[model samples]
Target: MNEMQKPVIGFTCGDLNGIGLELILKTLGDHRLLEICTPVVFASNKSINFYRKSLPDINFNYASGKDFSRLNPKQVNIYPCWEEEVAITPGQLNETGGKYALISLKEAAQALKAGHIHGLVTAPIHKKNIQSADFNYSGHTPYLKDLFGVNDVVMFMVAENMRIGLVTEHVTVADVSKHITKESIISKLKIMHSSLQKDFGIDKPKIAVLGLNPHAGDEGLIGSEEENIIKPAIKEAKHNMLVFGPYSADAFFARGQYERFDAVLAMYHDQGLIPFKSLAIGEGVNFTAGLNAVRTSPDHGTAFDIAGKGKADHSSFMAATFECIEIIRLRFGYAEMRQNPLRKMSARILANAVDEKIEETE
Candidate 1:
């Protein structure tokens, strides 16, 4: 595709001390990626140079700019967020690294809001170090939600075929139960249903909802979440989309039943993530659904142990980038289809008429 036709994807350099920069560099170094989308990294030259020196084998060509007025599709453009002299201690978590990570993220998010970039693929950030007066949020999902003024969003994880979305994210085990109410469940179902249809181009999405307790509370024998909360939510949601089950989480994945559905909605974090990561480790992409914008990130976190050693796997980061590009295209196509439903119906009828005429002539 031409440069104008391709979407410009903005990337944030998550925790400079971590493997964020390494993964970003490794993924963008492949020249073939440029053909699909324009990539702009929101980071500084000093940070990129630090990684380049650490790993001399990986060669990346990039353009440096303060703003994206003139973008070079041929090279990865580095939008300088900061240019200060800071310690570069890889694999060691410090406050300085967190500061830069937040800066990179804030700059990229601003650009995305202004329509300077089409989509965003954020690298992993250190949760503790990144916390500050400016960024008091728990993680990227909530931060993006508040940044764009979106009230509800789902933390949807995607692998090759297994797609999982969480009803409650970044909550403690004790708090998980309190959050699993009928209203919360129904809201998440709506988000997942819309995301599957629009972002994924699924005409009809089959979502398998997982139960909170063992064996789906043994049909209310073990717990009443299934009877009182989950069942009622699914009933209400069926009017909106094809939603089924509060299936037992254990048996659903063990029996390969999840493959039957387009996506799975788990009650909490570990319920869905444990199975997803176990199957798609190093390849999963975390996609934030039900937002006005498209944002994705690697399923994994900052590997502080192997940050500077150049041992970080870039597979998940690469997958996240590819997913972001694809979702953007899918959303555009879905919107176009929605805008001209009559045109599509008319074409379908014309095709049927042509087939009937051919049959008569034959």
Candidate 2:
């Protein structure tokens, strides 16, 4: 596709009772968004229409799954997953809606692999509700990893100036220590390095590796994981990647140390995400790294409390959508620094010849 041709982004219908449909509908309502990419929602026609009734001011068309081949940027393309009637009540959770959400996700993934879409920007999904429907997957990251057979996948949450990656996700605090290893840390670092330079357009990105214990174990006084596991992993990763860390988690985030690095590698979920969500709030974007296809989603969960109230903010969803576009451009060679539509009128890729030469000697 040419630069003028808008990229196609496939979206999954998140929990029907939640705010997924509302946010997707509200964001795509803006006609200007069509200028960047075609937003396609894989969902049931009835559910979308039901949500539409709640959002009366938004203007967009919905297409059925059987007619997916005829999609255009002129309307919100809907790949219907179900023909049955759905009783979608705002702010309420139902088991019936859970089944349809999974169906839509499966169809979206298949279409993405078939080259029908450039990338996927998913809405928030409730793991507990999906699990109640007999879905065994932990979350989207693990499911996508299994779908593409990608073992090196890592989840990075982007919040303005800070980006955080978890070496082990969706596990208990007790199990987190056992999951940490030199190999796992090294693998995540490599992916983070590649993603910063390739996807995020960072050149020679510096990464901070946070320690698992307090005060970085105080040189083996508080703990030895820093010296025995984290330090060694950082040293070994230097052969192929640039990484420096084993900093205390508490002080690292509190002192705003993350701003100094392109990305920070955290030991577990809450260790990295607590501070990230505090800063990013509604503007955070969750991106899956080390995958052949680019996938991103809102960092927050399905807000069942305010579902259907028309109170959900589209900022995070919009951020994810824009991030997907940049990833597609970089991956397909459409997003060179000079061609980026989001940048200044006469943007130029900075010439870093001096830094390259200096680094060669070091």
Question: Residue by residue across 1-362, what tens digits does model 2's lDDT show?
Answer: 56577788999978888899998998888878887887789887778888888789998675555554677776678877778887786676777557767888888888877778889998877777777433677799988888888778899999778899999999988888898999999989999998887788676777889999888888889878888999999999888766777888888878877777779999999989998988653488999998888899988888989999888988889899988988888766525544575552332235244233212110
The candidate 1 region of ten consecutive residues with least summed lDDT is 353-362
* TM-score per candidate, chains pooled: 0.93, 0.90
Q: Rate the local accuracy (lDDT) of all candidates.
A: 0.88, 0.81
Clashing pairs in 2: 65-80
Which residue runs does candidate 1 get wrong by more than 4 Å?
1-4, 342-362
TM-score of 1: 0.93
What clash pairs does model 1 have?
A: none
Per-residue error at 294 for model 2, in Å? 1.2
Q: Mind giving the per-residue lDDT tens digits that candidate 1 earns over 1-362?
A: 23248899999999989999999889998889999999999999988988988777877978999767799978899999877887878888899889999999999999998889999999999889999999998899999999999879999999886999999899999999999999989989899989987899666678889999998998789989999999999999989877788888998898887877889999999999999988763489999998888999998899998888989989889999999999999888777777898955764566456431111100
